[model samples]
Target: MSAPSPAPVSTLAPWPYPRWIAHRGAGKLAPENTLAAFRLGAQHGYRMFECDAKLSADGVPFLMHDATLDRTTNAAQVLSTTASNTGGDHPWSALAQLDAGSWHSRTHAGEPLPTLENMARYCIANGFFLNIEIKPTPGAEEKTGQVVGEHAARLWQGQAVLPLFSSFQPEALAGARATAPHIPRALLLDTLRNGWLDLARQLGCVAIVCNHALWDAALVAQVHGAGLRALSYTVNDDWAAQRLIHLETDGIITDRVDFFSPATP
Candidate 1:
């Protein structure tokens, strides 16, 4: 058989996301992946936000970072009557009833989890950019990716800046590419492996979001040379941010939204 065709060139326009993105909305300051966090991030002058999207059992797309709800929500106390440990096992109605914010602090009591559509409307209405990390349930990577991509495409139909999709799973990214090729994608890497650039190219990725320590001047230059942006995540300290800035990285995801001024970067 002939060789498989190479991935098509990315038609994505220039990168529009801000260099500084508030991680999980407002990071540790508020309930992550909740509307409260997003609003707090905005209050701190963040223009771009990064959140995780996964599908419930009923296939409704929602904002949640973990596979299980034990850490972020009172699922155990509230859903004790149910046998579901994973968020994907519950319908949207059940998931909606769980208090997603009370675990963070009493101040955010009763803050419910925000659906992907809820986030989309809020961001679109306020002209905010988003980096949507497709965090799928086990064995459902492709399905989650496709659904989230389709939803994002429809949600941001006429918006100027589409949500940037990123994932550590290649299958998910592939599913996304098949479902909505117009929305830009990025490869998320916690550890740099050999031929990563080739993999990113094969996946038609516009950027590579890496662990903050993985980036340096040469790597940044190499990614730029390959026509893809280089971004680092969870960068909270001044030195790390300064280092990434010095390397001329394209984007920086940070947990310290209140500490780091997005306006400067």
Candidate 2:
């Protein structure tokens, strides 16, 4: 039962338990954001998968991290035909041809960047929960959120696990809220300033996702006080895993999925 409009930030549901989450799908194993990564994460027993989402020039939502296609894709080399398309400026046609998976390995050579709808279909059909980080290109915040949010609303139309939308960009989060208020949102921060909680409250976020180094028990308690969850990202070791658990963080987004638990492998 999807809501016709995005819920007020205050009305979002509490996060489901199990703090261990897979970062960018399977992290270092599979090409991040590809279906392969998600499957690998599932094999590792991760119920939740986190990923970044940005809009292709044609408005398609694809998985990517940097604003430019240079680092991860073959866009810098093979697609030098248009290497100048920085950040969110490239058209979908150009992006679709980039070798998205080859840099990872040959086995994943043909893997193209996945659209939000494609990733959603994979996640839902497999009974997995999602934490989508709205990574908008420099000036594409509103557009990215609207496109991804609309696709998410359509994909999880009747699912029990409402997707968790998170972002460092307030505009992106706000746009997502405006587009699909029913889904939950989390405010991602590297450092917690004095008014951070108030800002999170204004954005209608139900959680705060902080860089692992910045999280502590006091911050966790502060988040809880505001009726929100506190989550951390990029944790890669057992010590940090135990630490987050001890702090009672609601969830952790990590690259080292294998270290967290025993699921498939």
Candidate 2 lDDT, tens digit per residue, 48-161? Answer: 999999987778888988887776788767665745757467777878787778889998898888788888888888788889999998888987888889989998998987
Which 10-residue window in model 2 sums to the lowest lDDT?
A: 6-15
Query: Whose TM-score is greatest here?
Result: 1
Q: List the RMSD of every prediction in angstroms.
A: 6.6, 7.5
TM-score of each: 0.94, 0.90
Q: Please identify model 1 stretches exceeding 4 Å from their true place.
A: 1-13
**Backbone clashes counted, model 2:** 4
Candidate 1, run of 10 with poorest lDDT: 7-16
Q: Residue by residue across 1-265, what tens digits does model 1's lDDT show?
A: 8999997775434778899999999999999999999999999999999999999999999999899989998898888665678999899998999898789899999899889999999999999999999999999999999999889989999888799999999989988998899999999999988888899999999999999999988888788878899899989999999999999888999999989999875
